[model samples]
Target: MVKGYNYIVNSFFDYLENRSKAVDSLLCVGLDPHIQHLDKPSAAAARDFCLEIVDSCAKYACAFKPNSAFFEVFGAEGISALREVISSIPEDIPVILDAKRGDISSTALAYSNAVFQHLGADAVTYSPYLGSDSVAPFVRRPEKGVFILCKTSNPGSNDVQILESNREQIYLHVARQSLVWSKHNNIGLVVGATDPYALTRVRDIAPNSWILCPGVGVQGASLKDALISGLRKDGMGVLITVSRAISGESDRAAVAAELCDAINRERESRKQNHTVHVTNNIAVDLIETGCVQFGDFTLKSGQQSPFYIDMRRLASFPDVLNRVSKEIVKKVLDLRFNCIAAIPYAGLPIGTAVSLLLNKPLIYPRRETKEYGTKSSIEGVYKSGETAIVLDDLISTGGSKFETINSLQKVGLNINDIVVLIDRQQGGRKLLDSQGYRLHAVYTISELIDEWLAFELIDNNQFILIKNYLSESA
Candidate 1:
C-alpha cells in the first residue's frame, strides 16, 4: 500500500489498487476462450486455453476478466471449468467475471453468490436496466465490486444509450445513478474505449469511480485516446481490457508486456496534462461565474479585503456548479468518512452536489436551532461515533468552521478532516491542524491567482495586490 493512503482492503476496488501498484500495471487481461481459438469445442479445451493465458499474462495483469458466456456454453462441464479457471488465477490479482448479470433482488442475490462465493471472483459486470433493486444484492457485500453497464462498445449502443431523458442522455443518467447506488463504495461504470467523448463525460460525472474500458484492439479503439479521456488525476482509475489482441498473438506474454508499457507511458502523460488543465479551467470558471471577485468588501469575519469569494453564486449556474463539485469530489475521494457535514448557508448546495455524486450522506449544522418544532441543531440523519468530513466554500481564519465542528461534536459525531474548494492561505489550515483536524483544498488563493495571471484573466497589478494581501494576512 502507498503511504498516506487508507489502504484497508475492504472493497474489490481497494484490492485492485493494491495489485495495480504492486505490478505497476493497469492492464486487465481478458480471458475469452472462443471456439476457434480452442483445440476443440469442449469444456476441457476452453479451460486449458484460459489457463494458458492466465499463466503467461498474470505477471502483467492487474486483473483477469473471463467472459462467462464462453464457459457456460458447455453446460455443467463448462461451468466446472469456469470455476477451475477462476481459482487457478493468482490470489493477489483480482478477477472480474464478465457476466453482466441483473434481475430482481432474490435472483440477483443468487447471481452474487455464484460469482463471489461459489466461483471466488472478486468483481462482476452487471446490467442496470432493472434499476437499483437489481444492483442491491451485488453491492451489499462491501468486499466485492460491481461495474454497471453504461455506454457499451457495441455499435447499437447509441440507439438506446444516447436517448434523452429529462434533457440528459441515458448513459449520463446511468453514470449519475451509479454514484447513488454506490453507498458501499464498491460500484464502478463500464464505459467503452471506442467512444472517447462518452468516456470523458462519464469521467466528469464520476471522477473518483473506477472505469472498465473495453473495445481497444478488436474494436479498433485507440488505447491512448481512452487513457487521455478516462484516466483520473492520480492516473489509476481506468482498467483497459484487451482480449484477442493478446490471445490471438503468438507470444501472449510479449504482447501483454507491450500493452502494459504503452498504457504506463500514456498514463504518465495524461496525469501531467490533466492536472494543469483542471486547475486552469477551474480558475477561469470561478472568475467567470462571479465566484471570485475583486473589490473592497467586508467579509463575514469583519475583515477588510481586496477581493471576495462568493461560492453561493454557484447555485445560479448549474454547469459551473457541477464542474466545481466534480473537482471537490476528487479531493474527497481518499478521505475516510461515513458522511459529510456541510457548513450552513454557503456549503449547503455544494455539499448536496458532492453528496449525490459520491453517494455519501449529507448533514448540516444549522446556524441556530429553531424555537419551534424538532429544534435539532443538526439537520440530517446521523448516528453517534460516526466520522464526518466537513465541507465549506473557503476557509479564512477558521472561526466559523469551529462553530459547526463544535455543534457536530456535541451530538457525538467525530470530525477529523475538512475539505473546501479554496483555501485563503491564511491561518485556517494551521488552526485546524492545531486542533487535530486536517484541511484539504482543491486550490489555494495563491495558486488561483497565479493561474489567473498566467492566463491573462487578471492584470499583473491585481495579482501583485492579492499576493501582498495574502502575505500581509499571513
Candidate 2:
C-alpha cells in the first residue's frame, strides 16, 4: 500500500504539470444504461456499444468518469453490466466514479475500499456538506482523490449559495472553508463548465487544485467560455467532463475525436489571444511615447536610481492604464495568490485597476485601519491562509516593500512574491532576496536603460550618471 501510495502521488503531480496528451480535458463519456435505450439493443448489445464508445474515445480522454445513477437503476443485473463495461476499458486511463456518496464514516470506508480495490477506480466524487467526518475516510486512501462539491454548475446553484452578510458571498465563503477541508488530501472541485462566472470565483479560491467541470456540449455551454473561465493564467487547470454528447453520438469514436480536437483548438486559440491582448497596442504605445519613462532618477529609498516609471500618470491617461493593467494581469494570471495587495498611494490605483479589470476582489493594507467599520488592517476581500502577490509601482531600497510584507504577514497572509511596474535594481533585488521573496518585474531597470539609450531618450553623460548611481547603491 505504501509503495502504491507513493506511486500515485508522484505520478498524479507529474500528470498535473505535463497533462496527458491522450485526454486534454478529463472529459468522460456518461454511459447510463437506460432501460428504454437498452431495450432495442439487448444488454449484450448495449455493453458492446459502451465498449465501442470507450475504444473510440480512448485517444481523446485522460479518464472515463462514469455516472453510477444510470447503472444503479437496474439492480443486480445493471451492476453486472457496469462491471463488464468497466472491464472492457483499458487500465491506463484513470476512471472517476461520479458516485457522490455521503454517509457515515464506516460506510464511507467500505465504499472507498470497494471503489478503489474491487472496482479499480482512481478517484471518486463525494459530497462534503456533511462535513469532514464523511469525507476524510476516502481521502485517507492516499492514491485515490475525492472531489468535493463546492460551487456546482447548475443555474439554480445561486438559490442557496448567493445569500450574503457583511458583503461576503456565501459561495465565496464556502470556497475559503474548502481550503481547510482540502488540506493534506488530493481534493478537487466539481464545478459545472456551464456556470462561466462561477468558474472564476471557484478558481480564485482554489487556484492550485484541479477542477472537474461538467456541462459542456449536450448542456449547451460554450467550450470557448469554459476555456477562458476555467484556465489558470499559465494555461492549465481543469479536467472537463462531457458525458451525453459524446456517448449518444451515432459514430461515437469519430464524434469523441472531434470533441477532443475542438477542445485543443479552443485552448490554443484562447492562449494566443490572451497573449496578444495582454501586451496590446496601448502597451506598445506606452513604450513608444515615453509614458513609461527611463532616465537618471532619484528613488524614495534614498538610493541613486537609473530608471523611473511614472505609473501614476496612468490615472490621467485612463486608456493607457487600462491597457497596461490588462497586460500585467495576463502575466500574473493563474498565479493562485489570494488578494492583489497594491503598495499604498501610487500602487493603490493600479491594484484597483487590475482588480476592476479582472473582476477579482481587491485589498490594500493600510499603515493603519480606518476609524469606522470593521477596522481591519487590510481592506477589501481578504482571508487568512491564502497566498497573495504584492504589487508595487517600483522597487529600489525595498524598505517600503519590507514594511508592506511585514504588515500582511502579521495578519496571517503569505507574501512570497512581489510584482512591480519597474525594478530599480539599486539593492532592491538583493534586499528582497534576503527577506525571502522573488521579484517579478514588468521592466527591469537595465531593460529600460537599454531601450532609452537606443531611442536617444538620454545622452551619454546622463546615462553615465544613472549607471554610476546604480553601481554605488548596490
Best by TM-score: 1
Q: Candidate 1 on 1-474: residue-level lDDT in tens?
A: 311235556677888888899999999999999999999999999999999999999999999999999999999999999999999998788899999999996788999999998988889999999999989999987878999999999999999999999999999999999999967879999999988778878888999999999999999998976886677768889999999999999899999999999999887654554356545388899888898899788977688898989988989988888888999999988989999999878899999999999999999998889888998999999999999999999998887799999999999999999999999989999999998999999999988886775455765456656766888998
lDDT of 2 by residue, 1-474 (tens): 222222444434243333354346545566655556554535564566567778788777766776666666656665566677776666556667888887777898898887777766667888777777887777775556777876777789888767885688766776666667644547777878776667766776777777788888777887765665676655576777887787777787787777777777877764664455323364345555465655546656464444555666667767777766776787688577867889887788778899887777777888786788887888767778788789987787788798888888888889889888778787788888997898877776665554443334554344445655666766
Range of the 10 consecutive residues with the lowest summed lDDT in candidate 2: 1-10
State the C-alpha lDDT per candidate: 0.89, 0.69
Error of 1 at 97 (Å): 0.2
Candidate 2's displacement at residue 43, Å, is: 5.5
Worst 10 residues of 1 by lDDT: 1-10
Q: Which residue segments of model 2 deviate by more than 4 Å?
A: 1-8, 11-19, 22-26, 39-46, 165-170, 182-185, 273-280, 283-474
Candidate 2 residue 171 Cα shift, in angstroms, is 3.3
